[model samples]
Target: MNNPVMEQSTPRNVSRRGLITGTGSLLGSAALGGRALAATPRHGRAAAPGAAPRDASIADGAQVPALVIGSGYGGCVAALRLAEAGVDVQLVEMGMAWDTPGADGEIFANTTDPDQRSYWLRTRTKQPISNFLGFPIDRDIARYTGILDAEDFSGITVYQGRGVGGGSLVNGGMAVTPRRENFGAILPTVNSAEMYGTYYPRANTALGVAAIDPDWFETTECYQYARVGRRHAQRSGFPFVFVPDVYDWAYMKQEAAGAVPKSALAGEILYGNNHGKKSLQKTYLPRIRATGKVTVSPLHKVTTVRPASGGGYTVTLEQLDTGGATTATKEVTADRVFFAAGSVGTSKLLVALRASGALPRLNEEIGKGWGDNGNVMCGRANHLWDPTGSLQSSIPTAGIDNWAAGGAFAEVAPLPTGIETFASFYLSITRNPHRAEFSWNSGAGRVELNWQTAWKRESIDMAKSIFDKINAKEGTIYRTDLFGTYKIWGDHLTYHPLGGAVLGKATDNYGRLHGHPGLYVIDGALIPGNTSVNPFVTITALAERNIEKIIATDL
Candidate 1:
């Protein structure tokens, strides 16, 4: 259904509860006034005063002042910032426009009782951990409006969020910014001093990030798993540190006190949080909608982007129904286009367009230098004395940072099923240098990422160094039953896929595509290989830096 662009009318600096009310309208409207575009041929025609684009028609398709693809971190930030600069902006997302409740009166499904709303476009459920003790834990479900999208490549399966808010919807809310020392290596061309001093802080404030309450964290069941990881790491003589998150600390306290329906305490991650977690839908998106100059279109996927004969560019869109089937094809024109479709999403489009001769001027570096962010998941078999609580919390607050020595940041993740299992699960982020490329496969009519399953060995080795030290200290062994019967390494997939269309290679220093003047790539696609952290903060920061430049010169 094509939704209306609704008014914001919420309080200034609204609470997350405000999202509960505006979310429906947010999706229905999509972005700002996200509705059907005008079909009139748009060539050098100025928008009539009070004539919304959704209300007018161009001869060929819709004509927009600026168009942003993907409502993820980069897109949302771009939309909000541009609108704030008095520019008309429209955002198109290829996923569900959330906000409507299902028959069960819930906005989303839980990680435990996964339903049709658990996954995106998949007949079977894909919980990150596919097995328990060599037994497959996956289930078949009717494909519907799920949140988490397990985008499968030839070699690796990437778990990303699919919806209006993008990664913010399904992630664990770990809003990590890369260390200042690592900025030079990650972005290569960006100025480190300016980013660390200005943009990073701007991104953090905009994200509403906050550290866990030290007192509550020390006592709550939510962090017992983290504490266990810390103890193990400390015993092994490794450094441990707290990780900040976008979740509301006050709300989390209420959940732990039984004052509210438990979300984090109820083992809700990967799917979505019913409350507390400050996903982008609860933050940037709402602000963008309030701007009045921004509009959003959800369930609309941008298929192609090429420079128009006159000026600006023409964008093709495929609209998908609730069943994830294409319902309609559309065309739109924009004076300026920004690509914020995450790393894989943007790379797929750029690589395909270049191969198809849609935008042959694109640089040869469009789909190169992609990595898994050194991500590895493993579970440790703990002894009877080291019982890692049955009633665990899903929100991780602490991590074992042996990055200086082992190049690893191990967050003590949880298997919170309300059952006492003597196992400790951890997801470590290491510095894996293995990079790959994405190329268009004409035979398959799709983009193929040339990442090898074996490339994650460097990450695995880094992770093993720390775990091995902990295992020696605690007399523990690796759990062979978690991933598969005898399988141990969770290297075939990654939750963090970095690179593809790297900064300073595929695009200019400030994310302006090298060959396409008005086209910009502003997502993880801009990062070379890895951010050495959770990446959302870095993505938001780089966008802030680049968009500021774009506004000053291009606008």
Candidate 2:
């Protein structure tokens, strides 16, 4: 455990280079044994290299009628809709189904005590932001099929999830719809009337969204930090609005009352939530599987894609085992391919495919219009009069809306350490017009993001506009203990990465890639960044609208 004296002594303004390292722990906890889940079956055994494909059914490489490249919100929507319309679909995911139980029978490793199961195919943990202080909190662990992925680009580190549920698995459960008035600018091609009236409600209902009981929120000890944030923001002449989340508020109440073992209470998020949070693994994917027409291929990465000689597309995949070793290579022919592989995933693939000439005429706009969703994270050291609770819930339930003047929507985030640190954290979503481009770097054999460290200054300025006011009103200093001592701003990482293949430009208004009839880009890649809130709801609603169009016209 980190000593209070050491935490206080840790300088708040460490260099970015000095912040990241594989040093010893500042805080530590032993892995708690999780509740055992039933032993669900895996799809198939992995094959050895140069051997037949793992699944005997697809060993001969049959023609797949409809294919979805990810199992996230967009992909699941595509899969379920297509299946309901009687189009046989195969959904490909690059991570585990997360159904298998661990040795201790837990489905996931707790963030506080991560082991091999804390990351996706990495030797050590790579958190989105490096430290709660100058001290190192990330641990060295074996490679395994973990949930969170902190994918590094040159100028930024993108935080995504590596499981059936994708970002839903690792994200805070806040589900926000973009303000109706602000929706037109981000996606001018999209019909706002339809989005607000038809799709957004449809999506929220399907996503199992519910508000925290306000009466309960006011009294709950778990949410005392949120109340503190609300009070602070209100005191600073900001309206603290209640943000809805996908977590079961009633269950959270149970967790708070010691009726259940601590999961969120124990500070377990940004890895995988063992309880409360409703990831796709719990909701959408299960319903898709119930349709009986969807087959998921996990641990398979599509490395190459090309047009088939006759028609449709041919995709080559490298299958992997739990240890990240290649098991076999195979190909599949698909009549239709839906790119639901989140913004970064789909953009990287598309950029590489275009540069490699596999998708020569994809579009001039294919790799354009990517944004970080204007993410800025910072912490304020509150005075003793305003003590943020030691026991905190990882699920954020409130935010400050300074978007009218400051152009920022800041969430009162959680530290969730079960320890009092006298800090108030805020993650601000700002309005940054600086979008990055992804270009294939043949030398590196990867698609490099054109974003630079300098690009974040715009985002920082927008977020600081709001925070500076709050800090001035409250007379509290920014916390140097979180994200590095005195490194108050976490400007290099983004959990909400949006756009690459934008809505109207990269593809048509309905997300169909311009030149390719059956190829579509449907995820966050379709939204040209800045959803004006947490993005999953907009991503879901837009996907709903697009799939409706394709099913009615294109199919």
lDDT per residue, candidate 2, 1-555, as tens digits? Answer: 011112122444433322321111133111121123223223335432211122412332868998789878899889988998999988888887666556654667766566777777788777655565455456667777677787888888888888777888888989998888899887898889999999999899888998999999899888889998988888777888998999977778889889987778867787788777877776777677677788888787888778999799998887778888879888989998999889999999999999999988898897789999999898776666676786888889889998877788999998665566666888999988888898888998888988887888988887777677777777655655446644668888898999999988989889999887899988999988788899999999999999999999978
Which residue runs of candidate 1 sit more than 4 Å off their true CA positions? 1-60
Please give each candidate's TM-score: 0.89, 0.90
Residues 1-555, candidate 1: write the lDDT tens digits.
Answer: 011212122244323433332232223222211223222122223422221132221223988889999988999889988999999987888776666555554566667766667788888877667665455667777777578889888789998888788888888888787777777778777889899899999999989999988887778766676778888888777888888899888988888889998888877787877777888877787688677888777778888898888799999888777788887888889999999999999999999989999889998999999988889988776666776776787777778887777788887788776665666888889899889999988887888988888888888888887887777777666665456655677877888877888888898888998887899998888887788878889989999999999999999
Model 1 weakest 10-residue run by lDDT: 1-10
lDDT of prediction 2 = 0.78
Please count the clashing residue pairs in each candidate, in the order shown: 13, 7
lDDT of 1 at 315: 92
> On a 0 to 100 scale, what is the lDDT of residue 23 in model 2?
15
Best-matching candidate per lDDT: 2
Kindly give the stretch of ten consecutive residues in candidate 2 with the minimal lDDT sum.
21-30
